[model samples]
Target: MTVTDSATTALSQGWCALSLLHGRIETHIERALQGGHDLSVREYSLLDVLSRQHSGVGGHLRMQQVAESVVLSQSATTRLVSRLEDRGLLNRYICDTDRRGIYTDVSEAGLALLAAARPTNDAALREALDEAARDPKLAPLVAAVENTHHDGRA
Candidate 1:
């Protein structure tokens, strides 16, 4: 094969591998959600973010921050937060310092849902990690995907 052809083939293979890995992770998360958790992966992600924020000094996360962290658009994040709020799982408060800013806090009900969903989330993640760890070549790929944009600078 020519050098150009070889490079193209390698790139195509990499794309295929990444797609397959993404599909597997999506399936695992879907299973976790459907196994009586009643929470979509996005919802679980939002809840997880809120939980960690509450553990920090502020006890809340701005909507934009949550959107960025979860890879959702601003409108999508607002809708997701609305759904959670409707379920009494979260509370939205306008920022006192920034009038245009909105912050979300996990409600008691939200915390309860997260607590109930923790086992399933933990098990799914552990299973995915363990399987990936079995293949040394896959571990770095997984880590890279997980930390794609997680540098200290933002």
Candidate 2:
């Protein structure tokens, strides 16, 4: 094969590995969260994100921002919020300054559930990474994930 072909093949392989690693981690976390907290990964993620909100300026997130932070479409985020609100785990309100703007916050019950589930989520993530690292094709990706920081820095 030509050098260009080799480079393309390598890139394709890396992409596949990344996708696989993501899927594995998500599935593992999903199972753990569901089994322990009756929450899907997406639900847990939404609760966690909303739990961080505060009353200070720039501390709150709009619906669109919440959707973006949770990596969901606006409609999907709305549905998720509705589900949680129905469960008394979330509360939604219109922005005082912007009638069109809506904000969401985790309720007291949501905070309790999230606190209980945080360890399960973290454990599942670590377990998934450890398992993935055993595979030669995925070890690098696993290492890269582990070495990454919450601020998006290495």
Top lDDT hit: 2
Candidate 1 residue runs with Cα over 4 Å from true position: 54-60, 129-154
Local error of candidate 2 at 85, Å?
0.6
- How do all models score by TM-score? 0.76, 0.94
Judge candidate 1 at residue 123 and give its lDDT: 84
Clashes in each model (backbone N, CA, C under 3 Å)?
A: 0, 0
- Candidate number achieving the greatest TM-score relative to the actual structure: 2
Local distance difference test, each candidate: 0.81, 0.94
lDDT tens per residue, model 1, 100-123: 877888899899999999888878
